[model samples]
Structure formats: structure tokens, C-alpha cells
Target: MDTAAADGTAAGNTTGGRPGRGRGRITSIEVLCAVLLLALLGQSWLRSTLDVPALRTGATVFVAVCVQALPFLVLGVLISGAIAAFVPARVLRKVLPRKENAAVGVAGIAGVALPGCECASVPVARRLIGQGVAPAAALTFLLAAPAVNPVVMVATAVAFPGEPGMVAARFAGSLATAMTMGWLWARWGKLDWIAERALRRLPEVEPGSRWRAFTETARADLVEAGGFLVLGALISAALGVLVPAEVFGVLGEQIVLGVLVMAVLAVVLALCSEADAFVAASLTAVPLLPKLVFLVVGPAVDVKLFALQAGTFGRSFALRFAPVTFAVAVVCAVLAGLVFLGGAR
Candidate 1:
């Protein structure tokens, strides 16, 4: 039995209506969500007619990016569901590295085996920590797994096609970001402040019916994950429209500002690492360095991630930890630009 099922949370009919017994009642939350989405779409259209080019542009980009990202989110949710249904917690804990530095090292490498986007990674991360994984190691896995995973690495390679250097930069940058943050956190970052919820016991998913477990886990994940994913998408979309087209150009040369801005965007948009490359591609004005910052930072921490982290760990820890990670990440990314992207030795 899954932990949730063992707890009886996953036993009843979640939808409450049989699949074929005529039809089912709609829940208030679902109805409200649909209404809100429709209203947002309508507002988007209404704003278009105003002839405000910036508004129209931003909305269009936002919507397009969100659409582009939906597939990734769906894929993430499905994969996460699969993990819940198939993999037992005790086994997963065993798959991790037993040593300290090795744990972080495995975190960088494990990105390949446990393949998925950031959204999917969140639950996995929580599960890892809950299984008595070391905090620094868990943090390393959380940061690196999404960024260095095959899905993202392949995309980065494609993004800078024929320019293998960019590919190398992407990989190195991501690794540096993960390891640096892990090391820094191990060295000075706050661990005691993490929330207690993130460490909650792993729900032992009962194999009542494979399909039922899948759906139940999927729904629970969606409910917990979907809303936060939406918030990230909305913020990213809003930025696509609201930020001035020329702003990136001006900020790009100001390396510090560029990195900070991208870091800020990372927090605000909370984009899935898998999809962030494409978003990075869209920031025409921002120099590659800043855009690189986006890819490096997105998977590590953001507003939605903060919420999840705070929920999972503790608010005080997240507040202290996220900022520290952010600062370290920015500095590391900058140095990456210097070493890899720059001609500096």
C-alpha cells in the first residue's frame, strides 16, 4: 500500500462519480479554476483590441510559452505518477549515494536516470529528503537533477547547435550551479529553518488497482502541483508581454544586473528547467550570459519552488536558504560566463 493509501487518503472515489454511472458532479474548485482561466483568456483578448502593442505582445508570448510548456508539465505529472505507482520509497532511498560528497556527486549524475522536468522533480525531492537523505545532498539533487537531466541537456545541445562550446557551457554551468550551491549550503547555508512538511512521511501507495493508484496519485500531484505550475506560467507569460523589448539589450552589458534580473525571473516565473531553454531563447535582448543564468537558476529555486520548499522544509529555512542559493548561483553563473563563455583563464 502507498503511504497515502495506508493512511486511507487514497481509498475512496476521488472523483466521487463512477466512470460510467451517467455523469458526476463538478467540484467547486474545478469550476472556479475553469471560470478564472476563461476570464483570463477573455481579458487577454480584450486587451488586444486596445491596440496597446506591448500588452498584446506580452500576452501572446505568455500564452505561447505557456502552451509550449504544457506538454512538459503534463509529461512531468505523468512521470511523477508513474514513480508513485511503480517505485517504492524504500527502494528509491537505496538508489541514492550513501556518502556525503558522493551524494552531491550522484545528484549531478542521477539527473540522467531519473529523467523529468522541475515540476516532477519537486515531489521526488521531497520524497528523497523524507527518506532520510542528507539535506545538502538532497538540495544538490534537487538543483542538479532537473538542470542536467537528459531532456534538458539534449535541448541545450540543440539550442546551440553546431556550437558544442555552448553545450559544454550549459553542462558545466549547470553542474557548477548545483555543486557550488551544495557546497555552500553544506558550508554555511541554513538547514534548521527548513519546514517540517517537506519531510513528511512517504505515502505508501497501495496497489489496490494499478489504474486507480495512478489516477489517485496523478490527481493529488496535479492538485498540489498544477496550481503552482500555473502561477509560474502566468508570471512568465506576463513578463513576455510587460518587459520592454529593449530592456534586455541595455541590461545585458550590465553583467550584474543581467544575472540578477534573470535570477529574479527564475524566482518569479518558476519555469520548469526542461522548458526554460526555450524561454531563454525567447529573450532576444538579454545576452546569452543572462539567459544562461535563467537555465541555471530556474531548476534550483523560484517563487513556486519557494512555496513548495517552505511547505516541505520550513519558511524560515526557505527564506534564508533561497536567498543564499540565489546569491551563490548568480555568482557561480557569472564565473561560468567568465571561464567558459569568456576568454578569461
Candidate 2:
């Protein structure tokens, strides 16, 4: 074909061809418009159908959870950003003990300073290992950073309201779980289990740009964590209404069964550590001890944390660590709950 004719044909195709592909690439605004249109069309039907007491209660609970938790989530992500972008890794190196066992204890306690979620901790832990910190120490920080942080503690307190013991139990259980795992790793963990990639050092962000880095980091984390928190609220609300009340009463009596069930639920939910408190609090069916287990275990060894650990530390590390962590967290949580919350009632 002549150059002019070919150019004309290309222009036409660019303007009008591949209609199906264009339609398939739907934008968020387009989806919103479609949803609005459907809502308008089904307005009468929805009004009649959704007027049931159950649906109203569920919706109210869902909204309440999201509203109550979102501000805390924002606060957590902001603190996480400050830790990631403002704090220098050199500060950790100087602060941690030279002796491996002592370092593990220090690292576990240092978790109080970093308010990031489990997902944020994985990369930081891997970087710590790469930067010549002991693997056990880094792992301790990894486990502790999410569960024992101030933002998460605040959220737990808010979620449980007057139940000050729940806050204490969760804090003690999660810290104990992290420290125990660290000690176990120091004694028996093999270096070969870690992937080499996890040992490579990451580039440090420039100190001067920390403010910009902080805001950007906070915004990104908030967007990702917020979506998961909203989803968790929806699921908790739905389960609140759908699950039979008798089920809770029966489970409440079976302490062991309730503990195991909540642990399993923690793994399945894979909730953000900052928001899991509200979800756990919403489950009034189980005893306080089980709910305590759920809060403690969810942040330490959920499916999300397992996957992140596998990707960063290697499959071998995750397989061994997750199960052990799960067992330890359950035991610690049950004991702490008994001590703080008082005898599974």
C-alpha cells in the first residue's frame, strides 16, 4: 500500500478499532457509574428487600467498624511511614546488643518503636538480616513490630472499650510469642533455611528527603491497608448476622475448641494488625480467651504474613516458622487471657 493510504488506515484503526478491548479495560469511574445506574433502576426493590431487621443491623455494624477503625488505621500507617522513611537502619545496629541472644531480646522490645503492619515488617526484617544483624534478632523484630506497636495497642484498646484486660493480654501474648520464637531460632534454626535473596542489603533512603518519603509511604500503605480493613468489616458484619447465636454459646463452653477455631479464623482472615482488633471484638460469640488468641495470632502468623515470609525468607523458613509461631501464640494467648481476662469467662 502507498504510505499515505497506510497512514490513513492506521489512524482509522486507532480511533475506532478494538472496541471490545477498550470496553474490557473498565475504569473506576465507569464502574461507579454502572453501579449508580443499577441502584437507581433497582431503588424500589432494594428499599423493600433491604428493610429487614437483620440487614439493617448488619449494615449498621459494618459502618460502625469501618468508621471506628479507619482513623486508627491511618494513624498506624503514618507511624509506619515515619519509621520506614525517617529512622536510619544504623540506629538499630547501634541499639541492638552484640551478643545474639541479648540482641533478640532487644529486638523484640524494639518492636514497640515501629508501628508498621506485618507486611511492612517482612522487608525490614530481611534487610536487617542482610545488614549483618542476627537472623534471630531480625525475626524477633519481624514478629513483634506489628503486634506490639503503639498504634495496634491503641486500636485494641479502642475496639474492646472498657476491657482493659484484653489490651494487656494481647500485648503480653504477642510479645511473648515473638521473644519465644526468637529464642527458639537462636537455639535450633539453620542458616541454610534462609534464601540468599533475603540476605542482600537494600539501598538506604536519603536522610534529607525523609519528609517527602514519609508522606508518600504513608499514603501508599493507607490505601492498601484501608481496603483490607473495609473488607474485614464487611465480613465481620455479615457473619454477625448470619451465624446462629447458639453456635457461639456452644463454642464458648469448649475452651480448647474455641481457641483452635479462632486461631484458624485468624489465619484465614489475614487481617491488618491495626484493624484485627475491631474484627475480633465484633465476634461476641467466642470467649474472651479465644478472641485474645485471634488478636495475638493474626498479626504474627496469618496467611498473609506466611506468604510474605515465604517470599522473603524462603519456603523452608515459612513452613517451619508459621506452625511453631501458631502453636506458641495460642499457648501464650490462652495463658495471658487466663491471667488478665480471668479464667475464660
Candidate 3:
């Protein structure tokens, strides 16, 4: 009787333990299946709800921005991963100038080789910083890569046909903004303002495991940066739809107001640098200087960039850097315009 009772007790314990282990836990796959079922059930209602013009417009802009930026973002992360996995810090230091200031200049010039938009540059810059590159030089490349790249230049030229001066002015203005900011950060910026995570160094990759390190780093950065990118796109689309059209009508005759307004709009719109020139060109009422300001400011600082910067570096760094960048970009654009566009065309 005693042996039989012990066996039954053990059998009961085993049976009870299995259900207890999974009592309240839900797997991701189960949650996903439930969500899909709900979505299918609400398909008609969801379609009707999103059918409004404003929502439709916002949706289009959001999709356009995401579609345009995602490829470049992917490219940036892949390069970043390669840097982490393969490139030695010593080699990067050797290739760049010894002095931070000179390295900033080199970085600015190097920007011309990357033909991607602003989204592509951020991850690359962050990776450079993580890999022991000077912050000033990496920051310069961050600002310049999207602005001075050949694709952007060609787009600018096509947008403003026969206006070689606009193209020249844009290049000069953007380069000036990048280098100036780099120098300023070198002089006054604090490393502590950057997030600890951003500055954290990865463990050295074993030679045989380099590819594994590369893929893992790329995947991690993509997942983190991609969320901020989507958030920026959503904010930009909402602002784009909400801003009144009358604002453009009022600015044509007022050069001072136009420049300031256009600069603000550049920040708020968060247009891709490669595509911003066309949008600026389409604003027929605005003068050339204002359009130039828009083009320069959009790439250097914008809502999208601010979000990415805040996420990657930290809120403190973005707050300080973005406002200063905006001011510098505006001043540079105006000066470049005076020199190249012959005082606002």
C-alpha cells in the first residue's frame, strides 16, 4: 500500500508541473497570430477609418520617406558592422590626419564618396566614434556625407536647371557647415554628453568569427536605429499635412521672414536630402536664398536627424548640437548664396 501511494504521489507531481510551467506565459508567435486574426476581422473598418484625405496624405508621405531612407539606412549599418568587425582602430587613425582639425577637413572631403542621404550617415558616424575615431572628425562626416555626396549634387543641379551657381552654393554651404561644427565641437563639446552605450567598445572579433560579428552588429544597429527612423517619419508626415499652405504665400515678398520661415520648415519637414532640392525648386514663390537655406538646413539638422541623434548619442547631445547646427547652416547658406547666387537671384 505504501509503495503504491508513493508512485501515485510522484505521478501527480509530474502531471501538475507541466501545466504550472506554462500557466500564464504567452509566446510571441501566439500573440502574432492573435493580432493577425483581429486585423483580418477589422479589415473593412480599418480601411474606412484611414480613408480621410489628411490621413491618406500623411500615410503617403510616411511610406515615401520610409521607402526612400530604408535602403540607405541598411547600407550605413552594413558599413558600420564591417568597420567593427574588420577595420582596426589603429588603421583608421593612421589613414586620418593626426590633428583633429585636419582630420575634420579630410572627413568632410571624404563625405563626397558616400552617395546616400542623411539616414545612411548617422550609423556610420556613430560606428566611427565607437571604433575610436575622434568625435569631431566623425561628426563632420555625419553632416557632410548626406549633403555633399554626388547624388545630391546631381539632384540639386537637375532641380535648378541652368543654375550652376545654386549647385556650387549648396556644396560650399554644406561643407562649411560640417567643418565649422566639427571645429566647434572639438573646442567646446563634452564627451560625456554622448550616451555611454554609444561610446562602449565592442570586444575584438576573432579572425575566423569576423563575419559573424559583422552580421550581428549590423542586425543590432538596424533594429535600434530603424525604430527612431520610423518615429521621425511619422512626425514629419503629420507636420507636413498640418502646416498651412498660406505660409508659403506670405513669404515671397519678405526676404528676412522667408529665410527664417524656410529654415524652420526645413527642420520640421525632415525631407530626405536627396529629394529636398526638388521640393525647394517646386516652391516657385520663394526666392533663391530661402530655397538655398532650406536645402542646406534640411541635411544638416532636421526633426528626423534630431530624433536619430537623440536616440544614438543622447538627448543632451542632440539638444545642444542641433540648434547650433541650424544657426551655422543658415549663416553658411546665406553667405554662400550671396557669393554664388548673386544675392538671392
Give the TM-scores of the predictions, in the order they appear.
0.73, 0.91, 0.67
Angstrom error of the Cα, residue 66, model 3: value is: 12
Worst 10 residues of 3 by lDDT: 113-122
lDDT of 3 by residue, 96-158 (tens): 786998999988987886444576578667777887889999899899988997767877887
Expressed as tens digits, the lDDT of each residue in 1-345 for candidate 2 is 699999998887788675456645889999999999999999999999889999999999899888888888888888888888978777797899999899999998999977688878887788788888899999999999999999899999998999999999999999999999999999999989998888888778887888998898888888878888888998999889999888888779888888899899999888889999998888877788899999999998988789889988899999999999999999999999999998787
The ten-residue window of minimal lDDT in model 2 covers 15-24
Top TM-score model: 2
- List pairs with backbone clashes in candidate 2: none
All candidates: CA RMSD in angstroms? 8.4, 2.8, 5.9
Model 1, 1-345: lDDT tens digits are 588775565344545444555565677898999999987879967656776876677667666656665566566556656766776656656866777677777776776666655555666777777878877777776777677776677666654556555556667777788787777666776546666777667776667776777677667756654565566556655666677667756676677787788878777777666567656665666777777777777777787778777766777877787887787777666677677776221
**Candidate 1 stretches greater than 4 Å from native:** 1-60, 155-167, 185-203, 209-213, 216-243, 343-345
